[model samples]
Target: MFVGCHVSIRNGYLGAAKTAFAIGANSFQYFPKNPRSMGVKAFDAKDAEACRRFAQERGLVSIGHTSYPTNLAVDEEDMRERTVKHLRNDLEIAEACGSLGVVVHFGHAKGGEPLEGYKRMIRLLDELLHDWRGEAKILLENNAGQGSRMGTTIEELVQVRSLLAAPDRVGFCLDTCHAFASGLWRGSNWKEVAAHMRSSGYFSSLAAVHLNDSVYPSGSFRDRHAPVGRGEIGLEAFSEFLQTPELAEVPIILETPAPAIGGHREEILLVRKLADRQEGVFDLEK
Candidate 1:
């Protein structure tokens, strides 16, 4: 249960590395460039080097998060082009930065069928996976079931994972808020959810998690993110996540807010406390 968070990489990219250390995180996620723009500025070689050194020095798992604006699942031809471009570049950047993986969304829905979106996404990922080959790993994040987004359900993700030449090159990053809002994971029944994720064949691509709280109610399918322990999802659910056996190897990162002087810091500490107090669950390698 390594704690991590998505931090700003705009300030020389190395800023995220510093943020990771500040929160005592075991890992960090960040964008290599501006997500909204098409024009890419040159990455500072020195800053990238600094990021690599900082991560190695602190033993932090650095994740290069892809820009989410481009929807690969969209039916538009232009979006497909843009998405393919980012996918290729993001993966290459991860390899260059000595990072573990590049995490990306399945695709935001625009009032379309999940299957249609999944097909588009599967095609896009397949194209990129062919080129990605090995080295830089990719993790597909499930959506919150908002609008027409694909991968909100585990089944859709399974289909996507089943395709692709680089199946082993890809994995999953479950968002806690999505899990709660989608009713796939909520309340004290997480044992069942954990079992379902495994017995249902979705566990093979499992990799990381985005720990978050929902601003909306369960089954809302909204994408609002709240601070940990301060929203509808609450701490008991997080307790369940900490206790799950299948998630032990996965990195649990706070996309939620923290307490004082905190973004995700307070949330990480809470999870760390829960993992530690729960006996032999999270081994603190001292």
Candidate 2:
């Protein structure tokens, strides 16, 4: 697996790459603009080119994460229109940056029938991909299944994708903490988990992974993320996850707490060690 962490984009996209390198990461995740607001800052094409060149030179990968409020499952016309506009912008930015994937949270159904939500998602994606030619694939991320959230299960995610009639531009992002909170697997039975995913035919659709530990117990339905090895999901479990053959070469992005609380550098190194035994690991210092 390609191990990395979420890097800040405060210094601009090129600076985000520099921070990733400082942390010993060959991959990273970043939001192109403010994640909470609909407003977006104009991107500098020169800077984007520079960032792309830097990544290519170092054999690095980057992923663009969609904003939190981007709800493609909205029923209202205004909200749905806004969602389409913003996500289309997201796709453009990701393509300009030469990102491999754009990770997005599939929105909640707002207490409506699950089929309705799926249909909404399908229509939104259809519009997004219609006459689209972009290098970055849209990756629908799994949720914690809290409240009216959808795409928590492999079946639901697969179902959503199936409606698209084999769109090559669509994929999935499996969040470890979300899976744990939703009680998919408690970091044990990972082999069975991998087998099930493969059997469901969704394994090949995985484009990225959010490597996080949960702050709460299993089945908490909470989305709080702890640093790797510092929460309920222990290091041993992560070790097993990294060694899973099916996830090979996938971009594993850490969405853990910032470096001050959990240390992004350390977490990236830990995951790297898990992924590559030839890297030579010493014991993790407390």
Candidate 3:
């Protein structure tokens, strides 16, 4: 199984890859630029190429995450343009790094009608990708049902994709913490949740999983993430979800709070142990 945590790319692509490897991770996620800003640093093709080569040799998978400042549902002219520009740049960077794809938040409605907000998102994504030809996909991540965020429900996500100009190039990334907080998951019924998603058509487009534990109880609508086995959702739920046959080939990324790389390393080991135990395997050392 592919499992890893979100690693900082401040030291460049190769540096991030090395950090993931050191943590015993076979996969990792990274922000393509500053999460708080729209400014992106100059791309170093050589460094990206080296990182790709190293990841290929080590059987590592990498995924890029878009900046938090991006809001695809914006109705304003200048903000919409900038958001599209930044998103396009993110896709380009992901492609250059040979990443699986880039994960993006569905954006907020700013207190507007939910339907209008979804329409805005569909229009903007169409504008951004209508003529674009990139191998890297745009993976829309589910929200924690906080405020006016879109894509909180599988129905909403499916609706937006159906209206997209390039639905085939778009996909979904499930965040466990968000799922619990949004009440889409009751923390113990992953099988039911998975079945619901599959029937709604979201599961077929799922490309990645954010294997996080929630800081709050189910239906809390809070987006706090805690370390594996140290949160409300607990490790048992994760173990059950990890063994789901539907997600066997999808990469799992940890977005849990960690004091350092060591914290994430421990969580990674714990996840491996959980999966191994469920499968009746005993290869991982305690």
Question: Using alpha carbons, what is the TM-score of model 3?
Answer: 0.94
User: What lDDT, from 0 to 1, does candidate 2 have?
Assistant: 0.82
Ranking by TM-score: 3, 2, 1
Model 1, 1-286: lDDT tens per residue?
A: 6788888875766787887888788888888777775444466778777888888887877777777575767678777777777777777777666677888877855677766767777788787677556476888888777776556778778777877666888888888888878777665677787777888787767777888888998888887888776778766667767777777767777776545565766567778777656564234321
For candidate 3, write residues 138-194 as lDDT tens digits. 999999988885667888888889888799989989999998999989878888888
lDDT of 2 by residue, 1-286 (tens): 5788888788888888888887788889999788897655578877877888888888788999988878778899887777777777777878877788788887678885777888888988888787678788889888897877577888888878888843788998899999988888688777888888999988888988999999988778899999887888877788888888877888899998877654587778778776665334425423
Ranking by lDDT: 3, 2, 1
Candidate 3, residue 8: CA error in Å? 1.0
Q: How many residue pairs clash in each candidate?
A: 3, 0, 0
lDDT of 3 at 192: 89
Candidate 3 residues lying further than 4 Å off, grouped into runs, are 278-286
- Pairs in steric clash, model 1: 109-148, 109-149, 258-263
Summing lDDT over every window of 10 consecutive residues in candidate 3, give the lowest-scoring window: 277-286
